[model samples]
Target chain A: MPIAITDPDDPRIEPYRAVRERDLVGRQHRFIAEGEVVLRVLLKQPRFEIESLLLAENRLDGLSDALEDLPPDVPVYTANRQVMDAIVGFPIHRGILAVARRAPLLPLEEFLTALPEDALVVGLVGLANHDNVGGIFRNAAAFGAQGVLLDHESCDPLYRKAIRVSVGGALVVPFTRAPSAEAMVQALQAASFEIIALSPAGSEILSRVKPARRTALLLGAEGPGLPRELLARSRTVSIPMSGGFDSLNVATTSGIALHHLTSQKDEKPLPR
Target chain B: MPIAITDPDDPRIEPYRAVRERDLVGRQHRFIAEGEVVLRVLLKQPRFEIESLLLAENRLDGLSDALEDLPPDVPVYTANRQVMDAIVGFPIHRGILAVARRAPLLPLEEFLTALPEDALVVGLVGLANHDNVGGIFRNAAAFGAQGVLLDHESCDPLYRKAIRVSVGGALVVPFTRAPSAEAMVQALQAASFEIIALSPAGSEILSRVKPARRTALLLGAEGPGLPRELLARSRTVSIPMSGGFDSLNVATTSGIALHHLTSQKDEKPLPR
Candidate 1:
């Protein structure tokens, strides 16, 4: 059975207040998930724990199946559309919201060691846009990338909008942050991963590159792509694009690269 | 020479007022182009005529090169940040805007006849999201797709947000709208185009398919993909994704599909 709250100020639904404003200031290790699809994704992922749910009164019947699987301790609260709008400080047409605690950040070394020999992953550097980060995660999951490695400068994948934009991919995909892009490259190299830097000025075309046993594709922000030094060190590969138009949205680039790298069979033997 | 406008409500700038509100209603035949990059693109394209430009006073010096090439009759108006923001009914940090007349829509038959012997193009059906449409156009241009064809249900590609999201690809790419998706298929088939419908349930894997001399890739909205009848009629192809995750952002899907199709050498000879 679900709890019914009448007032927008009900302390039980406090976390859902002024979500738009709270999105700017940090959520203190908590993140909000919106829409029915995302909530279903959140419930399925064992990595994160659901704190609570606030749904429009009309949404309860539709969400019965998802609610049935929820752990009994998790509170499900319902409010009328008026109160729901007042609490969130905006009109949320989806009328589904949940607050979940973020999983503890795993150490980079532990994460690297856990990867299977035949692994493919994505490394993001200086990508500040939430939509890009989210899109990359969505692609990572679609293409079977083992995990996402983010440099400290990259924005949080669990940010509300990022999670929403990802279509719940942020919840499904495993990710961890590194100190810097250089540090990430060093760690990946130590793990015997072949780092492929994607850039417009790359030396090799993407289609021709054969994947190693463990491959990592590194992506950078749009204007200032991966650092010049990083590109020089790694096996840089470029996607052949139309003449005079070099730009592809970074997230879109990831999708194309991931598809090529993952779809191709590893032709070369593993380096000892 | 540039004209200076001191007031937000000046009759000369009436077309630029309350841009956010005006975007919801139709803009007659005019479309708004925001940001310096889009402004540059709008100026370069001869297909569309520039009616006027509204910019913050500070932007005048930076745009001198582009402005120099402008037609003598096209008006350029400058206003302070305060007046510009007030006129637009919102804060536009880009501080640059332009209203340009939309190019006349060419008939589907005419557009099909104009394609080169080995042309590549994108066909959109039921894609209403501006961002997705914009992103698809961006991909289409990056991959050297000669043009875009839209079904009647598709939203206007010239919508301001779509143009901005496309990174100005909307301005660069030549597009035409058809009366219906079925009509588009009939016209494309008559022109001997190998129409490839992108859907998750597609019979052929994308990587394995050999494109023809003239290929047209069809994309539909996310939730409800291309109509089953169209999919049955076309050479339907699917991107091989990881198990349990079938969704890809429509734009990202276009990027991956376009890159693969364009990069591959067309192995089939043209049919008589």
Candidate 2:
């Protein structure tokens, strides 16, 4: 049986409400996502923990077949549009929103050490936009970046808009937060990483920069780009430009540069 | 001598009003821009043809110096946020809205034939988003993609959001719409251009694919990626995942990919 949540203050929907409370601990704040597309993709994982589900009165009728397979009793809630909006901070028109938990991250040391030799690591400098981060993560998944390394000043990857923009790449991509970009650059250098900062000024062509097979691409935010300190520590590689152009969004730049550097075509032909 | 017309129906503002009018000759719609950043950039152009200028009282003060530069007798309109919103059909808090005559595009044949033998081109395929279009144009300049070519389905490169997202790349980068992706792809092939389709499913990794010195990269919108038919006609290439990732946004991807192909990594030791 589904419960009706007519009021915004309903404690039964606490996980969903946590995101609405801005004063909640930064990391403690949680987010909720609804929609068949998002749910359908995420539900494929058997280990997924869904705290609760809110489906429309009519919408939940066909989902019984799906509900029977759930390992957890996800308390279902129903409401009219007004009631639903009251319960969540925003409108819940996407039909279904699940209060899924954010996974605890692995320690940076373990995340780095356990990664495979060919693992591609993405570290940010000062990416501020959640949408950009999420989009970057989405691109990372689409092009095959292993996981992300969040640096100081970067936006929370699990923020609602970020998750929505990333199409859940923020959830899927393995990541850990790093202290300072400068410190991370040094740590990566110590790990034998070719810390290449994507920039507009540098002459080292991004495609031609031979990362020692173990490359860690350092991306900056949209506007100011990587600080001098970060760039000074890393190999400065640039995408070539023609007339009337400037630079690209950091995430897009990351995707193409990563593809060019890591793909096999640019490398020596192996003996077949 | 900026004159304020009390009527939204004022004929003096017809060009400005028609900006929202549909199918006003697909090529001749009045262009509208709101906000200081876009207005500032557009003002820098010597060829900007103003229809009417609307400025919030504060913005009027901010733009007084630039406003004086406009030819005397150019019509000016003043309004507060409420009045501006009533006229614009949307809330525009930027306190500035400017209308201009659409700048005509350079003839495609003329543009193409004027190029040098080694001319670099930014060939776009089915890029549906105006923002992405503008952004790619911006990145094109930053990464050196020079002139841009758009497929038919692309939103007008000069669309409002496209111009905003491009940060004025539309004004700087020379772009023209191709009749079809097919015709353009053939023309590129005829030119001995190595037409590379950027895709996740590309058989050869981006790093491994040795593109011909003169190249055209075909990119489609996110999600759908490059079409299979288009892929059949061109060399399929992919950016290697940096972190076992998926793909980047079209503009970001283009920026990096173009950077790779265009960078001055000359003296690259010939492959063994």
TM-score of A-chain in each prediction? 0.97, 0.85
- Candidate 1 lDDT, tens digit per residue, B55-157? 9999989999988778999999999999999999999899899999999988998998998988888999999999999999888878889899999999988
Q: Can you list each candidate's DockQ?
A: 0.83, 0.52
Q: Report the error of model 1 at residue B197, Å.
A: 0.6
Write down the RMSD of candidate 2 (Cα, Å).
5.0
Tens-place lDDT per residue, model 2, A29-143, is 3456557645654565443467778776666777777776555567788777776666666766776777666667666766777776766778987888877898777876665
The C-alpha RMSD in Å for every predicted model, in order, reads: 1.9, 5.0
| Docking level of model 1 | high
Interface RMSD for each predicted structure: 0.8, 3.5
**Any idea what lDDT model 1 has?**
0.90
Q: How many residue pairs clash in each candidate?
A: 0, 40
Error of 1 at A112 (Å): 0.7
Candidate 1 scores an iRMS of 0.8
